[model samples]
Target: MPNRTDLEALPDIPMDDDGPVFREPWEAQAFAMTLELHQQGRFSWPEWARYLHQEIDKAKQSGDPDLGDTYYQHWLAALENICVDKKITSGEALAERKEAWDRAARSTPHGEPIELDRAIRRGEFDK
Candidate 1:
């Protein structure tokens, strides 16, 4: 298992590193939302961290140690894994949601929410 420093040192993700040198505003927003939910007891921080470390370890064993380049992807992937582990959603549910979204997007009002990503955010596809 990783120590406190190793886990705490994870880089800012979901940002274009070429210009900004750090996470962009929306990138920060998404990260914050996830962290906020975790802090609110929607999910355990230890569990989330464990999933991330597992994924990171898999990446390391698979021959990539330069995790800085894939931080957000790893984070997102680990989050998905945790959601699935916790039975929050499933692949079949997401496929159905996507179909529902396709139909909804065509006829729904302009202010209506997007479904696919929303489902993920709401843990609807976690199983």
Candidate 2:
């Protein structure tokens, strides 16, 4: 997990919305691992931030500008690189997951997995 202080200090990273941006290339790699670990329910936010700060400081001390600026394009590159390196799941895997979800959804009599469309059609929300 990352520290609160370091996380606040780090620049804003825009992936989907507002979040931490990896400052160093290796930092990005760590971020990717952290994300995977998060998905797997390993490290919490505090621990992740602390880890990120430790990594960024290491990059600064090492004097490697490859991590890039506040945006840290290199960081993003590193994340992608590491994600590929780890290869726990591929895009195809996600597609398969989605396909399975769809099948399960169609099996349900509610119409959709979320039931949003069915609810709307039923006018359950109408007042």
Candidate 3:
């Protein structure tokens, strides 16, 4: 994983005295995933930066407030784009996974773990 100095070098991402701030657990997860992927040589920091900047710009063009809170949302968007660009996964596959997650989330009780159903686990979405 990239060290603190490495992360601090990036001016685009928000980092305070305590390091990066995330509005939700998933936001932190996404941020960590990005770093992990970069460390694995899936993408370079510069490439990730370019994609993140582009995503933020696109969101701004679409009237996103560009508020600090939505930083992770843009980050996730860029991550998804990079994944697709690298041919790691297809857009349709992501959409299907998202839909499956939504279904799982909706079906589970509040505060319960949302588990993918058997169909989703069986790669039914790819069918």
Best by TM-score: 3
What are the runs in model 2 whose C-alpha is more than 4 Å off? 1-33, 65-127
For model 2, what is the C-alpha lDDT against the true structure?
A: 0.50
Could you tell me the lDDT of residue 38 within candidate 1? 76
Q: For candidate 2, lDDT tens digit of each residue in 1-127? A: 5445535654444333355544456666756665666567554555544444555556667776633453353344334333444574455544555565575567678753443344433563233
* lDDT tens digits by residue: candidate 3, 3-102: 6777766545677786777778999999889888898899998888889889989999999888777888898989999999998888988998898899
Clashes of 2: 9
TM-score for all models, in order of appearance: 0.54, 0.32, 0.86
lDDT of each: 0.61, 0.50, 0.85
RMSD of each: 7.2, 13.0, 2.1
User: Model 3, poorest ten-residue lDDT window?
Assistant: 3-12
Count of backbone collisions in candidate 3: 0
* Residue 96 lDDT (model 1): 73
Q: Which ranges of candidate 1 are over 4 A from the true structure?
A: 1-30, 95-127
Which candidate ranks first by lDDT, i.e. highest? Answer: 3
The alpha-carbon root-mean-square deviation between model 2 and the true structure, to one decimal in Å, is: 13.0
